[model samples]
Target: MGHFVIPVTGKPVDYVAQIFPKNNLIDHGVIVENAEVYRQANSDKIKVYG
Candidate 1:
């Protein structure tokens, strides 16, 4: 959630993969095009992992 791509912004973000580390919040809450990949236990309340 650091400085990164804004969906409404019409600018290109070339360093998206570097913006956030690979974590459950970004995995499940985002990437709406592929829901199945994000599906997993405790994804909704990710504090369980925190």
Candidate 2:
């Protein structure tokens, strides 16, 4: 599995609030956000890695 990281400009509580509507848990939201950011930040990397 690949690893991804998302930089959120807020505390965990704040990020959890923003993520609740889109996911069931804070960790899931973080993963989703990280995946998106990773895709945007390194499309070429994904292409090569995948």
Q: Please report, in order, the local distance difference test score of every candidate based on alpha carbons.
A: 0.28, 0.33
Question: What are the clash counts of all predictions, listed in order?
Answer: 0, 0
**For each candidate, C-alpha RMSD in Å?**
11.1, 11.2
Model 2 clashing-pair count: 0
TM-score of each: 0.18, 0.20
Encode model 1's per-residue lDDT on 1-50: one tens digit a residue. Answer: 46433222122232223333543234223222222222132244312111
Model 1, position 27: C-alpha lDDT score: 28
TM-score, candidate 1, is 0.18
